[model samples]
Target: MFDYSKLPIRNVLCLDMKSFFASVEAVERGLDPMETLLVVVANKNRKGSVVLAASPKMKELYGIKTGSRFFEIPVNNKQIHIVESRMALYVNYASKVIQILEKFAPYEAIDVYSIDESWICTDGTEKLFGNRWEVARKIRETIYEETGLPSCIGIGPNKFLAKVILDIEAKKNGIAECKYKDVEDKLWPQKVEAIWGIGKRMQKNLNRMGIFKVGELATTPLNKLKERFGVMGEQLYWHSWGVDLSPVIQDWEFEEEQKSISTGITLMSDYGGEDTEIVILELCEEIGLRLRQSFLQCKTVYLGIEYSKDIGGGFGHSHTMNDYSCISNQIYKECISLFRKYYQGFPVRKVSVAVSNLQNFDNLQLKLFDEENQRDLSLSFALDEVKNKYGKHSIFKGVSLFKNATAKERANKIGGHNK
Candidate 1:
């Protein structure tokens, strides 16, 4: 019962590259990106390392998919090629792809969602580029021709529709469109899970309510949905109608401010209790610096420890405070408390920490005991300036000299994996 006549009808294209990482690797090796069987892993030497991407043929023929471990990949499959991740090379290719996209739309109209996907608004470009369909086809062809990255294009009147169509339909057809007029026919028949935002847990809840299809959820009372999912339920209802008012302006930086700051590391080797605490202290500094970098303070701190596979079981716990903070030592105190309370003393292979329930640093109130707090804040600010001007490792923690320290190793990596 929403007013369809009043909604803006813009031509948005959500573009996704097919098996981006694996395809890029295949093309780099002079293999047919479409026909080749390849898998990208962080460390091929580590048998348990997860696969980042798998080529189409590998998925179709061998059932090997992204997230499958190295050992899970069939060694008997002589056709498969295993390659280590090269994030810098892939990012360079993505930048070149961005240059190609700029030909059709300006930077403000483009939103790069991730390493492999983007949304471009071609609202008024139909005058110069023929039509939206033709523009999509041309862009798809131009990308494959110049960079050898096969792409799928999903056309819609808004960003959400474009993304869903790209994820659900264009993935099968290479290029497809879902209009507001066609939402009933195009989006309703799919399983609830197939809709972009409805994950397994939500789908399960909907199933309990006898809502197995998109149409059922759409038709359900707004109050019912809001009761179950709060504001998100309202969003789902509008999304079900293929409605989105957001612009494609790379708004992610400004629109989604940091709600939390965190850092985690999987130790190359198992760590004992004392060594784990030292690593946690180092991680606290990293997290606190990130909070300061973003000008955020957090009221809740989270700690997670994954025991070595041989030991089994892991624990995740959190501590919330009335006072918001972004100081490293204060954060370290909470993390250590949580660690001691729940840690089973098993050999730990991985450790993680996060601070959330955020507030701006500008809003942080000065404490009654301002003398020590000011000194700590001043020292941290000075260290941040030094690191920003020089290099990250320009200054190092004394504990970094400790045997179990991962700060130096992580500084040299990209997203905790080899660069």
Candidate 2:
């Protein structure tokens, strides 16, 4: 008889690059890996841009991690090196890695954590790949050989445990394998914060209740955890015990069931006052490009603005459109209209453009009076062809020139290996 009380998940592979960005830079510059130099890089100005990546060598020197501010490091009398970040290079490398992973497993089943890390289902590949451990080793080797990027992999019964084992506990033991029997020995010794789902806010909350370790979290009452964190709390409760019910999905096309399309950018510096409107328009244009690219017509435009250094709160507004559209000009105008209402007093650090309630533009039957409809459809198809044949940037909408960094990066990445 199948046990209804038990959580069931199986055959997960967690793959993460070793100090991804810094490693990529080291490869690019031919830097000595043994050198005691801390490499930190960001978007535009070193101080202004969020530290995008740090090498393992750099991590030891300055104790810095990705997304840390540049100025936070007190000048340690030791010599340190800083490099301006190149997001484009990182994205290109990331795309190649994804392409390679897809050949081994279905794309939807793979969960992307960032530019350098992902998790995929290994259940179906055992026959073809021999064993799970061998599969993990092969994937790691392939990534290292192709990108000059070293990867650490962890295989376990579930995705959550697989990833936690890879990033946290396994690093100390070289690599970790969590079988059904070894779950208690392998996972419970780690601190509560060491688990993937727990963050600073959640950690602080758990710590207050004397739950300082993963073992303690595993033993906590599920009902109490649910009360404390609601549905997400329940997730944490199960995850601590090496339970993740999610399947190794081959595609995220199912995500379309919920309406969403978005574009976001972290600016080099705060654009507070007058320039805010211009930036919003630029962001809207880029969002429209993405919307058209996906062939999605949206009826709602939402704007989100985050103030620099303020994690507590920010401004946001949503507007319901009179009609649905993937047309850039129409979306731009609607975004501008929404911006006029939502853009308030704040020195914006990050901006996001989102459109929801999406549908097919052809089926929407928008009014013919709008020239934007015809223009956008024609342009989108052409751009799609360019991207398909030459790559994602073979052609881009003019609006992207003013706003999108990916477009700029695509233009810059002249020659690189792709398969």
Candidate 3:
């Protein structure tokens, strides 16, 4: 139903590091990443800690994958090496891999999708790198040689096709290519959930509509799909036909005005009563700091609390403030109000704070007589300056001194894992 001749077809390569975290640990210990039975857990000491990554052999033999608890692994297996996650080490390797990609493509042509995955556009580099297949092989081999981490490459005409092919085929074959013409034969036969963006919930929704396969979804009426899923349905229809318009090269330096600034943490242990309030204050501090850094102020504050698994459910509510603010205490005051009103006093395992309905700092009109408001704003900026010059942990609210506050510990982490 789409015109193949009218579409943008460019050489896009999707690259993924094999068992990234576990492989990094294996390589550090002088073990073969593919052959070694290794698992990377969030915390080696915590039995309830989640498995973050597992080597190919570990996954194949023990059925242990990411999200599997530490206790699920086979006990006392001499072949299995369980290691705590070293986010800094993994990030260093990821940076090296990106540098390797930069050797083959310009920085602008490379988009770092995640720590261990990326998309490189090689539209004009075939003459320099031989061909797309040659470039993919060179990239895969060079990454392994330099970082000792195996990689897979999927080549296609755009980002979606490349990523889908990478996830489905390249991981098995090391490298795979899928062109528009190959979509029907190669992609359509796969289940809808196998598509890059479709999850189990989406799969069930499609199943109820009698669209269980990619081809089935592709053949369904666009108007009908759009009627049901709105813009997302139109996107699904186009992706099924291998017609992605997303640019392979992303401009990372571009900054769009943000709608919200937020932060959250999953506590290592459940907190209650006053401890939960302390956590809320820390989160508000983080959100407020982010807002000030971006020169934004928020009109709404939101708090979310997730109870322990045993408790099963929790609450999330937001309150619009009388005025916009980038002050931590102001945000915290609104969040605490929400918490006090909604919290059922169950043990809290996770907490989040957010500020939205943002406007530029320039839009905030100073109240001439409100000296307290003026002083608070001045003090917030002064504190930000101190923290920026020294460090995040260099200066913090007194509430952070509370035993339950994670601000100090989190400042040392990368993505909430050990650095």
| Best TM-score among the predictions, by candidate number | 3
Q: Which consecutive 10 residues in model 1 have the weakest lDDT in total?
A: 361-370
Task: Report the lDDT tens digits of candidate 2 across residue range 1-419.
Answer: 11325656567888887777677777777664335355655433445556767777667766777877878655554556666656667777889888878877777778897777888887788778767788877787777678777678787887777888887755555457776556677778888887787889999999998999888888889999999889988998777777777766755455535478887666656776455656666566566667766667788888777887863367778888887777666666776676666666767787777889888655436445267566766676676667678876566556446543334543453322111
Please, what are the lDDT tens digits per residue for candidate 3 over residues 46-75? 889899999999888889999999999986
Query: TM-score per candidate, in order?
Result: 0.80, 0.76, 0.90
Model 1, position 145, has a per-residue lDDT of 93
Residues 236-313, candidate 1: write the lDDT tens digits. Answer: 888888888886565545676667777898888989999999999989998888888888888999999999999888
Error of 3 at 302 (Å): 2.2
Best by lDDT: 3
TM-score (C-alpha, index-matched) for candidate 3? 0.90
Predicted structure 2: lDDT? 0.70
Scored against the true structure, residue 219 in model 1 reaches a CA lDDT of 93
Model 3, runs deviating above 4 Å: 1-3, 251-254, 309-313, 362-370, 373-379
What is the lDDT for 164 in model 3? 94
Winner of 1 and 2 under TM-score? 1
